[model samples]
Target: MTDAIKANIEKILQDSHVGPMATVQNDKPHSRYMTFFQENLKLYTATSKETHKTEEVEKNPFTHILLGYEGDGFGDEYVEYEGKVTISNSDELKKQLWIEDMKHYFDGPEDPNFIVLEIEPIQIRLMNKKGKAPKVLEL
Candidate 1:
């Protein structure tokens, strides 16, 4: 990735933390808005172990995520992220991904039902920027 592309991607990751994450189930796409925490290019999102997503990911570990589009139509930038998923319930990660808002869904970081989905990127693209075409980040 070029410096500009990398910078834009970092901006997006910093600016956009909430977006739809898609997983495959029964050969169909299942998507839901999730809050993500990223490190380098890896992304992680907390979810319930009992959720359909956890099961779907177990069957098919692939996922696609869309982040950084805040609905401003005119040349707004966004990211198209395609990756592999790993369901994690490690206390370390649960604690790391814990946030106050998640209390609505989880009791706490140690909540037995709480789990995280760790995404390992397979492909990523910076999309819909002013005049440039979609740019794929080499990884």
Candidate 2:
């Protein structure tokens, strides 16, 4: 990817917004809203081990995530991520990504059931109204 394109992608990733995450379950697609956190190109989300989403990821590591579109009706800019997810139970990482608001779902950063889904993007497409074609970003 060009430097300008890379910068744009990073901006979208850092916008502090939630996005739709799609995972496969029983050979069908299941999607839900999920809060996103990123480190460079890698994305992370918090979830409970008991949740069906976790189980789905465990069974099928491949996932699709849509980010950056916020329904403004003006901009069509967004990103589609194809990635492999790793379920993590590292205390240090959980603590680092933890926030006060997460207590609503997770007991705490150290909650045994609390886990992090780390998405390693294998392919990313940057899409927008400005471009006639979607730009594929190199992972």
Candidate 3:
């Protein structure tokens, strides 16, 4: 059962690159859409060092992510990712997740202001697939 859920989650992560990432600020939930890159069960998204989300994560590591709906309608499967976020300036990772579109935000992956938020999921729930109850994966 766990294997099936893990595989389902993996496929969701791979197919769902864009999602809303929510963080806490002043005890209020702050959320914004972001393009995500995944490695195994981990997720990464790029942002500027000065972004509000960056500061929010430093103060509060907890985050919630929703990804993997194809927008075809009610049956589209998705995953809810609840995790801890870490800010990273490592060029190795920056290069790995970099894309030409990012040029508008920074000079390059080496830009000092370029940073990535690393999210490690504490719980993942497979959602909205065939009307079944949400299957959870707790790490």
Candidate 2 — which residues are off by over 4 angstroms?
none
The stretch of ten residues in a row with the least summed lDDT in candidate 2 is: 126-135
Which residue pairs in candidate 2 have backbone atoms (N, alpha carbon, C) closer than 3 angstroms, thus clashing? Answer: none
The estimated TM-scores of all candidates read 0.95, 0.94, 0.96
Best candidate, TM-score-wise? 3
Task: List lDDT for all candidates, in order.
Answer: 0.90, 0.89, 0.93
Q: Pick the candidate with the highest lDDT.
A: 3
**After superposition, which runs of candidate 3 have C-alpha atoms over 4 Å from their true positions?**
none
Error (Å) of candidate 3 at residue 103 is 0.4
lDDT at position 109, candidate 2? 94
Candidate 2 residue 14 C-alpha distance from true site, Å: 0.4
Q: Give candidate 1's error at residue 135 in angstroms.
A: 0.5
Q: For model 2, what is the error of residue 57's alpha carbon versus the real structure, in angstroms, after optimal superposition?
A: 0.8
lDDT of 3: 0.93
